[model samples]
Target chain A: MCDSCGCNITPGNRHLVAEGEPGHQAIDVLQHLLSANDHAAAHNREHFDRHGVLAYNLMSSPGAGKTALLEATLQALAGEFRIAVIEGDLETENDAERIRRHGVPAIQISTGSACHLDAHMVHHALHDLDLDAIDLLFIENVGNLVCPASFDLGQHRNLTLLSVPEGDDKPAKYPVMFRAADAVVFTKTDLLPVFDDFSIERATRYLRELASAAPVLNASVRSAQGLAAWLDWLRDDMRALRARIAGGEAVRPAVQPDGAALHAAESAA
Target chain B: MHELSVCQALVEQVVRVAREHGAGSVARVTIGVGALSGTEPALLRQAYPIACAGTPAEGSTLEINERPIRVRCALCGAETDARANRLLCGACGDWHTQLLSGDELLLEQVELAKLAEAI
Candidate 1:
């Protein structure tokens, strides 16, 4: 009997029987499975560039205060920056509704069973907004530390967030997310006094060990700590992006691994 | 798991390739999965059969090749393996190394069975 389906043939006959056939052939594909998604991401990048928008992909574990940080960012910088959001979630338009309450245009992408938002989903969300009218676009990916890190949504920057209550060991456990981040935000700082296990030093140490160039900052919507630095980072990035856009270049961060420690490491060397 | 989605795409690609080649059925599909590709091979293997169900590629064997992460040391000019969640250079213990491999998700090859000769 065949091993595969117990047919009236020799066991494990598929490979042998197929090879013996007259017209059987093997073809080399050598294709990346995500090539289609990458193509869509390239298109999304072009769209953002043409409209002079600085797009950011925000990733984090669930309940890491991604929405809260965005709310704070919009509240603080809305006067100077025309901001919009593409909120991704498994369900509920709650995030979109929250952003809309702040008078910012927002689009909600409900992935149903999908864990991460692919570039195609972002591309579809783009149609709901006037791209030229917005200066910055934030794609808040579904709250997943693992799956979201592997997918790129054509954002100019990839931001990863970790709340203090979630502990400082997240960087070590989810290194892929930290490695891909352009910036890391430590959120819910107001609870740090209660959560003793969370240490900025340990988190920074992990980042250093990974040789990451992403800058890390702590913020709390309650205390407004580090909000200025967060806003300044955005402002600097927006300026750099606009300059690149005007020069017909892709809006990449001017410096790789942009952070205080990276600069210190370079100087020490 | 995300493996289900990946397998779905894999089946789609296999079917498309089979159609392009005018083959009646797929005999085998070989995939190269990287260690750091964020995919669990075990889960993927389990999901493949389900993804192939109701498709022309059903019952096709999925042969997976595990690709190890390779990092090139900037200081020692040595290429070595990168352990899980660790990105340091295997040689010279330098943190400033470049990743050379282990993030790929490729559909390397496909074996197609010809239509059975008219009997």
Candidate 2:
């Protein structure tokens, strides 16, 4: 029997069944799966513009303290910035609930078995939020460091987080996320004294070498250490985003070709 | 993990392409999985069938070509295939080499058979 169609066939049959056809054929496809996500991301950017929201896509590993950073960020900036959050997870709404505790409007996107959040998911999440009331929108993408880097959530800035416990070699291990990031935040600095493996110097050097002049901030939400600098950078970024939008600039920065060296290095294994 | 997400996107694209080309079923879909793109081709293949369910590409075959990492050596000014485990130059053993290829996830082509032509 043919496994694909469950049709009985003799062993001497000349035609062997294939998954898609009777025989295998190679097609020279040169398209990117992210192309669909990219198109939807562009539309998402336009939608954000119409509502006057500055979105920031946050990327990090599972235990990198992304939600904690958001909680602290909302508490500190809430008086000034009308912050909202869209949390992506494979299962729970725990992160979204945590952000909501800060009194900011928050939405949780459960991607089911998928590991990353695409632009279409963000578009759907946006429809549920009151865009007019949102000033600074934060999207905490799924925890994996790899896939989220390939997706753009229509954010004005992309922030990648790495906790101290994750080690200084993260920039070397996950270069593409670091390269695409507008700013890299080193979280869980409060644990630095406890772990000898954490080296700020090594992390800084590697990040500078990979990102070439991108900003790196070490922060700990528990102690509020370095949180001020983080908030200040966000303020500056949001201000600039506002200026650009007001100037009628496009929602996103200029699109560089995917073949750029920086992108290649970061996305490279 | 991420392969599952990529697989889902792949199925959606194959369906769209098949419909546009007026094909009843997809014959083949070619995708380039760059060596440095952080995608595991084996994992993508394992997840492809599950992600393709209920789509036009349900039984379609996913052809993934493994792309080698290409890098430009900083010391020798030469471009060569890079070793995935180490970013060092293939010829000079320089760690400061700049990467050139193997970070792309490109969909190269799609083959579909016309409904009337299918045996």
Name the candidate that leads on TM-score: 1
Residue B52, candidate 1: C-alpha displacement in angstroms: 1.3
Chain B in candidate 1 has what TM-score? 0.93
After superposition, which runs of candidate 1 have C-alpha atoms over 4 Å from their true positions? A1-23, A245-248, A251-269, B115-119
Assess candidate 1 and give its TM-score to the true structure: 0.87
Candidate number of the best DockQ: 1
DockQ metric for all predictions = 0.47, 0.37
Listed per prediction, chain B TM-scores read 0.93, 0.88
- Backbone clash pairs for candidate 1 read A213-A257
